[model samples]
Target: MRKALAEVGQTYDVVVLGAGAGGMSATVFAALEGMRVLLVERTEYLGGTTAFSAATTWIPLTRHSRAIGADDSREKVSGFLDRAVGNRSPKVLREAFLAAGPEVVETLENKTDVHFRPRPFHPDYLYELEGATSFGRALEPTPFEAGELGADLALIRPPIPEFTILGGMMIDRDDIGHLMKMGKSLKSAVYSARLIGRYYLGKMRHGRDPRLLMGNALIGRMLLTAKKLGVDILTETETTAFVTDKNGVTGVTLRQKGIDKRITVTGGVVLASGGFSRHPKMRTEKLPHPAPEFSPSAPGHTGALHDLAFAAGAHHGTTSAQPCFWAPVSHRRRPDGSMAVFPHFVFDRSKPGIISVGRDGRRFVNESTSYHQFVSAMYATNKDGSHVPTYLIADAKALKTYGMGMIRPGGANIKPYLADGYLTEGATLDELARKLGIDANGLKDSVSRMNAYAKTGVDADFARGTTVYEKANGDPTHGPNPTLGALETAPYYAVKLWPGDIGSAMGLVGDENTRLLREDGSVIEGLYACGNDLQSIMGGVYPGPGITVGPAIVFGAIAARHAAQRAAAARRGEAGQGEAA
Candidate 1:
């Protein structure tokens, strides 16, 4: 049962800060080990950014891999990481994550409600890497029934409004494909009808669709498991400071409902508070110069707990290639007078008939590349901040077929978007360039070159669809090149893209056991870190989908098991002292 801060006990075997994927995993695993665990979330909703993600967990060589006949092994995965990440992160940490990843998956499946199924053909972003595979490395959570949570369903952080359709109907990739073919295929029509029917039926009762998919499903399952394990959950509670002594962190001071309380922890305090992505000072300090004005990351990642961790001697990792994960995002004002920031991840960019260009009206990056790499290319090419707000242009056919940024597919009604200036439209290429304040001659020349490349079925400039990963994201039905098509259709459209970070990469350094380390490389006795709180194992290199969540789960479980062992040792020592006295 959920407990108010006042109702919770004075002490717990484990007190986990943050209710994100990492923190919740630590709480669930600790409780499964017969320990009393308390999960604290600064926000009223749980899940943090995980709930906003697709929840593609990239853990290789598990039972799910075997079931899917994926020929992946530790050696292959390690080689891929070595080539992709080099020595940006510690080898020991990566090795630890690989060793514990499968174990975490197995334990969660056997002991909790958390479950994942292998993605059939999801390719790694860097498919050209030495040991990158085409499938089975990434696992996605199974769809869950939100009704199972009863009234507590509201506690799971809602998906972004832009990600849903028809007033809160969440759909996954498969659903998208089926919905796109709804009128063309009988099978798809039936499938989409049932899906939409169920959504409407559920929304009538719950005010939101009861079917949960993607990150929502993962979090819902974890929340149900936490409830089953009797893990005490306190939401909207702020951890003001870590209560420490000579031995290190022993408790935490919390403020809930404006009432302050200190709770003792016997096992350990696990820090999984997302990261410092939203911290006002840390954003200016850690993020790149000309810091992004907006981010789509969860609001709970304000670095409040990071300050406490820093005071306790924990320091952030510095060897990462980038301090934060990047995504190209577009923003629009909602009816409620709030800004809706949508991260453009694998939606319309890789599809045919689209091209991204800088102020000079010239292409700078491969349009079919991964979102992270695309934004990285933007930064690399944006010496004068011209590429910071690059334009993604698509012709009429492409706009109606694939959609662009915040605009939905089918192009049924775009007047609102145009009237609001969320989308810029032009009847001709020259007109589009003029409206966007770009060199019209350069845009016309770029389009001409793109047309030739489309006819030849090759992108000589950037190789947009050469890799398996790129092709997979592109329209496979398109001939010549899956990701290449001439933007010759009249009535073009464009949306401004901004570099938006989804999560932090640089975080408090921790050991293989998830124990937070001081600046001198010594462990902080009773403090541990996981999720974005710990330095990313991939060294800020986005190797594949779910790279962050994969390590988060592994290290979160590792931290809990280590804490359980420490609690056992402490009990033994106390008993020994009692007997001696």
Candidate 2:
């Protein structure tokens, strides 16, 4: 009835899609099991979101954080995530995510070169929010050198424009700001410099290497590790169709540089090609920005592979997705597509971090919420047809002391946004109100109340002064009552900000095992998805650091592990039915 083994030398245990952390993580474990693994990524680079725009990988509310003096648990973590989607996250997936998170992080640490250190100072978005712990759950990847990547390193995108990796070095979070600080102990200063210098030397030798010492560092390093472990990486390729037989998946039709090719395999297909963030057509019809210009996410997050999977008939949960998280560039864009930071002198003086307001010039929600929520709020508002331009309001002291109102002008120098009306400024509460084109009387009163709270360090309407860190990050020396001073300080600054998103958080649904599924609730044999490409386990909400990459690694590994098991069975005369929970 069936053809015997063809021995075409083309089949293997697993084929991981999207060489980014999500896909790579799955491949790593699968390959570790001694199975032949083939990995495919549409982008020239690997590490998906982690490579292009990952700030941190979140693994909060874990047992480690609690054992280390911070208090938290799965119940609290589940509370936040479930509240976001009203329990839409399937119980199996939720339990699997919680159960496997720590194990996944632990595996990366002991098995491969991926290193993670706890960031204790990084607090939860809402410090007092239930189950919110100050540390433990936030593990930042150590820096790495790009030289280890050898030839493949050049293909991956650097974390951002300024942040580059070279050789095998990896940079961690703790060392970032310390690199610039001046008052460290003599020994500490000398040690930090030597460490940084060593990394620089490595990068120098491996020109254009990634800084594998930090968040992006580990992501890049591990990808190279997976490749070294016999993972076949076919770049610039697309899985156009899922070749199937009576039992399940049989192979895939792939395209490269517009040429069609087919690869028949007995193992499964893991779809980690990422979300629809960069799709020009999807951007126009969905996303808030409505612009086809560059999104920081790596290219090929077009949801094309997703469409193909759906056509093949798979059961999935929610398909509507967006980069549930990300931030707007505070300044403006550089020619190389990076953001320019407004002088710190400005932020230190005044600027309550601008608010991306709707048509009304009022506080919508906590602007300080994680960047993910900011974009989500923006998306939600836009979906309802609300035209909102962000407004950044700051006092004149905010102006003279800091480059308070400035964004990248794509010009030679950073220009004050206020000068070009990209930002609006004025003196006096009423005048400032008039400049913003809002009800001058309403704005004046708003200023009056905001000032009163600033005086007493207590915001009555919005409790802006509640968080000590918020104020600490603000002007601590702003005189008699810091935070208040009546904004009465001559000249005010207000700039408009758009809702910038990191990437969408919806795509092919997967189970706790991270098995890729169809819209109708059937698992597409061998298919798996994670990161922004899978429906967010957090329901498009960011609960903590590494929120994007953390799950990616967890589920990616999960997907690969099962694929390996299935592959081994097919090699034998046994019926290759995958084991399930």
Candidate 3:
């Protein structure tokens, strides 16, 4: 139950910081093991960035995959990870993750309200790598009814405003196709009508749509489970410092409502505090030079607790290839004056009739590559920061068919976008290039070359559509090459793209059991880390969808289990001493 700082109990078996996917998982699983748990969040809401995500969890060799007859095994997944990640991360950590992933799924399903279903054909981003499969690893949360949460529904963090439709209705990936084709197909029309009808009815009654999808559903299910297990949840509570003894961390000092309070823990404290993406000092120190100005991460990831962790002898991971995960995002100002940052993930770039270019107005990278790779290419080619703000240009047909940035598919009224200068439009490619302050002749030559590549069904410059992952994100109905088409339609449009990180990758170094480790390699007893708080298991490599959340859940559970076992062992030691006396 959520309580004020003064009302909460002074002691808990385990205290979890940050109520994101990893922290919530640790709370629920710890409670299942008969521990009294306390969950604290710095923000007013429970879900962190997880609430705004697609919630595609990548865990291999689960019952969900087996039920779907997905031809996969430990050997295949290991091989794929071996090639994709190499030695960027420790092999022991990877082995532990693979071994415990399916168990975590099974435990959560059998003992709690948390549930998931496999995506039949979600391919790994590096599908061309050894032993990569086109299906079965990615699992999406089952849709949940917010009504089930009753009065506590308001505590769940809302999805990103740009991601929702009709003010507050959340749409799933499957719902997109139906809504897009509603005008053309009778079946799709019916589906769209019912979905919209339900949304309106629920909104009228509850002041917000009660049906939750994607990350909302995932967090809702976990939140419901945490409540049922009787975990003490406190929001708007900030951790000030770690309370430690000669044995290690024993509790935490928190500031709530401008008053400080100390909460004792017998098991351990798990750090899943969403990492240092928002930390002013850490971002400049750890992130690449010329750091990104915009990020889609949650507001609570200030890395305040990281200082305390470091003071207690914990160190950051050393082997990560990058400090943060990358995405090409577009920004626009809303009517309320808040900036609307949209990450162009798996949507416009991979579709046909679109291309990205540097200031020279020539293609800098393959348009059909993954979002991470696309942004990496931008930075790789941007020696003088010219490509920091590149242009994503699409003709009228492509813009209407696939949507650019925050604009919806088939969006007709773009007056506001043009008025705010979020969008640039011109009658011809040369004109578009001129408006964008790029070399007009270079753009014309580039378009002429692309038109030739389209006719030949090949991207000679960068090989756009050769990968299965790229094709899967493209329009299957398109002929010859799913990701290739000429940008010949008049009234071309463009949006400025910038490097934006979704989350931090380099974090506190920990062992396989989620226990924090010092620089000398000794474990810091009674303290653990997971989620973005823990150094990413993939070593900053974008291997597949849901890699972050998948390990978050697995290691969260591992931390809770290890803490419980330690408490049990301590109890056994005391009992034996009494018997000997």
Candidate 4:
């Protein structure tokens, strides 16, 4: 299966593998510094897992945050991280992230087309913790027009199909709010009309409205800048082996659309190949049971880069307390007989009159908690190791107001979901318990307790709506406790839940410069890793929105800058020798 090349395919100052947020950022930053860069991606499309994400970046103390009057002081953020990560936190890595993160955002925004808007009131996930602010830290990409990519439009991965409406009209956070209130208010009706009108016009001219938003928009902006700077992008190419001699990572051997090719590089290699979310072996070894079969990430997350790096003598990090970042996901079989998974990030769990229960029909954790905390509680409570599914229970009124999983609000076509076994319905508590094979008595008691809490506006058992984080997810317009309302309506429903990981927290141990380290604490000559491949600075704790993407952008830039600097120094050395000759 192996073939040796008669001659190397090409040479470049830097060769960046993978085209997700990390790799794209690295490519742009490296190219910005005048480095001849070759960016390769395994899939035909760029963006990778990040394209399917919400595209929020949690960059604290950013200029936008400061402008918006955020109190993102160094002491404050550090206190929050200390509580979240504790002893596992790497001080230097955290310091580097805090120092370089804002600059990276500034560079992309100022020098490139990559633009971001501040989420001034976005609360940190653990708002209950000390030093957590009620607002100002997270930044999101502004919507981008896909037409700017031209023929390369097809090369970008689209967002999850569930997030779109009307066969490819991608909606953002603001659009969702407007669409939810459409026809009920005049303002919402006008906003919805304007959004749909533009989508139709875009579709009429282009096969698909290339109006990219969220993660897709973020990647698109980076790709546009890379193209303008003449960065060479090789899609459908995978790095199979790293070529080395006296120095580490001299180049890489790649299989490009099936043909074997070897490319030499003088600068260095940057590995930002997303994460190993889809790798079965890695999942079994690292992640807990009920490992997700339906990830929103790209299918090429096979952990190939991890294997390659490990073989090259890279050591992994010790932040295994929380190995993977998790979210609860609901699944349904599409018309094509494929499973469509939709992550319940902010949609159903935190709404009033909803509670997540285990097989025994007992509420396990605070339903309004962060996705990471919710799933962690699920793992901790599944004591017997049985493969029973966790269920999100809601009544007809709650279902209509806030749809469960793939089911949209306003009671949209539940007949098909029930027929497909994706949703379970019960006219009463006992019937629902029997249908789900849960304890009927336990289910009745749970309902009674919920009704009591709803009436009294207090959840003594789990304190669901007590924190700012929980209230943020709740319907603020609702009564006493926005997250706690009586589930007393008839025809109750439930959707099975599974633990889904966005990316791995445990990764290769690397330094602030993004250089991979050996177990003995020495750096691997020229090998570098960033993104989800590098150990999370938060030490596996999901502190807030965009924590994952923020570090990915920062470390990717750090790796690129380091490689470019080395290449420049080497070039100058060669030039001096030639002049002496």
Per-residue lDDT of model 3, residues 220-290, tens digit only: 99999988888898999999999988758989998899988999878899999899889999889888767
Q: Judging by lDDT, tell me the better candidate of 3 and 4.
A: 3
For all predictions, the C-alpha RMSD in Å is 1.2, 6.1, 1.4, 2.7
Which candidate has the top score in lDDT?
1
lDDT of residue 580 for candidate 2: 28
Please identify model 4 stretches exceeding 4 Å from their true place.
1-9, 385-388
Per-residue alpha-carbon lDDT of candidate 1 for residues 422-505, written as tens digits (9 for 90 to 100): 899999999999999987887888788888888898999998899999998888889699999899999999999999999999
Candidate 2 deviant stretches above 4 angstroms:
1-9, 60-67, 83-85, 126-129, 162-176, 183-203, 284-294, 319-323, 329-333, 336-360, 379-387, 396-445, 465-491, 574-581
TM-score of 1: 0.98
Model 3 ranges off by over 4 Å = 572-581
At residue 357, what lDDT does model 3 achieve? 89
Instruction: Give the lDDT ranking, best first.
Output: 1, 3, 4, 2
Worst 10 residues of 4 by lDDT: 1-10
For candidate 2, which ten residues in a row score worst on lDDT? 1-10
Put down candidate 4 lDDT per residue, 320-434, tens digits, no spaces: 5688888888888789887788888988998998888887788988999998888788888887742236889999999999899998888788999999889999999889989
Model 2, global lDDT: 0.60
Q: Tell me which of candidates 1 and 2 scores higher on lDDT.
A: 1
